[model samples]
Target: MSRFSPFSRSRAPQLLTEVLSRTDAFAPLRAGVEQMSAIRRDLDALLPDYLAASIEPGFIKDGKLALFAAHNALAARLRHLEPRLVADLQARGWALDGVRIRVRPQAVKDPVPPKQARMTPVGAAALQALSEHLEPSPLQAALAKMAARHTKR
Candidate 1:
C-alpha cells in the first residue's frame, strides 16, 4: 500500500482528443455557407404586397428557394416570376446556380412588395415612322415586313 501525499498535484496526463480540434466543433466555419439563403433573400423581398399578405421565406436547397404563400394565387404569381428573379439574383452576384422556386401554403398576412416602375420604355411611334420612310433596300424591306408581322391588327 502507498502512503498518501498531502501536497501532490493532478497526476492525469493532458488529453489530446480529436473532436476538440476538428472543424465540426464550430458550425459557422463551414465553407460555401449561404448565410442569406434564397428564400430569405428573394421571396422575402420581391413578393408583392397583394400576394405577400400571407407568405414568408422557407427552406433553400441546391439553389432552390422554397416560399410559403397565402394561397394558390400568390404561389402562381411567384412561380410566374421565378426566371426574372433568378436573373436579378445573378446580377447581384447571388449564389443561385439555377434558382428554383417551390410554393407552400402559409398562415399569416404579409407586407407587400414595394411598388416599382416598369424599367423598359414602351417603343414610341417615332421608331415606326422612321422605319416607314426608309428607302426599300433589302434590309428595309425585311424590317418593314418584320414590323408588319408584329404590327397590331
Candidate 2:
C-alpha cells in the first residue's frame, strides 16, 4: 500500500511563492506611480484576474488601500460587491488594506479605441501626408500636438 501525504510527489505543494511571487506587491504598486506609464501592462501581467482590470490597488497608508475601478461599470459592480472580491483575494493570500474603488468616468470615454495609437503602414502613410500638406495654422498645430502626444513614437 502507498502512503498518502501532502508532501508526496503527486500531492506536493507547488512552488506557489515562485508562481505568484510572494514578495510584497507594494514595490510594483509604488514603482507604478513613479513611472506613470506602462502601468496597465505591468498590472495586467502580474495581478490576478479578479483584480486585474477590475481593481487597482493604491497604497497601504494608514492600513487602508486606495483602489480605483477601471471603469464606471466595474465601479458600480464593486460598490456593492467588494466584500466578496476582498474575501476571494484574501483566500488567495492577498493581504490588501480594505479595497476602495473610485469610478473612472474618463476611462470609459472610448472603450473600443486604443488610448495609445498603434498605426499600421496605411495609417502611417496618412499621417505623413497630413504632416506634409497641412499648413502650420493654430488648429493644425494643435492637431499635430495631439497626434504626437497620443501616438507612441
Candidate 3:
C-alpha cells in the first residue's frame, strides 16, 4: 500500500508575492502593475466621482498616460478634461506630457426585471369583503383601494 500526505494550504497573496520576487522575468511586469495601480489611485482622487467611476488607468509610456473610458461619451468627456488632468498629475509628481483616452466598453449583463406581485380575482374579492366587514378606518380604506386597483388589471 502506498502512503499519501495531505497538501498544506497557502495564502494566494503570499504565494504570488513569493513567485514575483523570486522570478527575475516577472519583476518588470510586477513593477508596471504597481505603477499603474498607483497612477489609478492618484487619478481617481483628482477626478470627479462620476468620471472616476467610469474610467480606468492604462499604461504610461513616453510621457503619455493612457486611459480607458467605458464608452464614447465618457471618452469625449475625458478628452475635454485631459489637459487639466495632465497638469494636475504633473503637480502630483507624475511626469506626464499628454493623456490618451480610449473607449473600452465593459461587459455588463442586463439586469433581470423584478417579478411584480399580482393579486388574483379571488384574492381581490376576499380583500373587498374583508374591507367591507371592517369599520371606516385607514387600513380598511387602503385594502379597498388596493383591491380596486388590482381588480382593474
Candidate 4:
C-alpha cells in the first residue's frame, strides 16, 4: 500500500506509529513518553496492587523521579516508601537520587444527587396551623407562604 493511503484502508495504530516516528519534531516527545511509560511499568511492578493503581509515574529529571498520587493519603503512603523505592529503582539501573510524590487527584464526573424536600408534610401542617392562629402580620404571611410550598394539594 502507498504511504499516503486513505485512513479507511490503513489501520490507526500503523498510521500513528508512522507519524510519531517519522516526524523529527515528534521524535523527542515520543521517546520521552516511551521512557515515562517504561518507568511507570517498573514502578507499578514494584508497588502493591492497590498503591499501583493510584500512582502515576512522571518524568525523571536531575536523577529524581516524580510520582503523582491520586490523593494526599496515597502521597503520604508513597513518602513512607520513598527510601525503599529509590533503592529499588537504583538497583534496576536507574540513576535515581530521590522520589518526589505529589498529590494529583483524577478528575471524576459524579452526578449530583436529587434535592430532598426541606420541609416535611408534618412540619408544613404545623406551620400552617401556627400561621392560622397568629394575627394577620408579615411573619404569619411568610409562614403561610412557606407551608403552602411544602404541603401537598
Specify the highest-TM-score model's number. Answer: 3
Off by over 4 Å in 3: 1-18, 115-153
- CA lDDT scores, all candidates in order: 0.58, 0.58, 0.89, 0.89
For 58-87, candidate 2 gives per-residue lDDT tens digits of: 654553445677777767766676676566
Q: Write the per-residue lDDT of candidate 1 for residues 89-150, one digit (tens) a residue.
A: 66766666554445665557588989663222224244455668998787777665655544
Between 1 and 3, whose TM-score is larger? 3
Write down the RMSD of all candidates, one decimal each.
Answer: 19.9, 16.6, 5.8, 12.2
TM-score per candidate, chains pooled: 0.39, 0.34, 0.66, 0.61
Candidate 4's displacement at residue 17, Å, is: 4.5
Q: Write the per-residue lDDT of candidate 4 for residues 11-104, one digit (tens) a residue.
A: 5466555678987899888888888878888888899999999889988888889999999999999999999999998998888899978899
> What global local distance difference test value does model 4 have?
0.89
Better of 1 and 3 by lDDT: 3
Q: Candidate 3, residues 107-148: lDDT per residue as tens digits?
A: 997999997989999999999999999999999999999999
Candidate 4 residue-wise lDDT at 29: 84
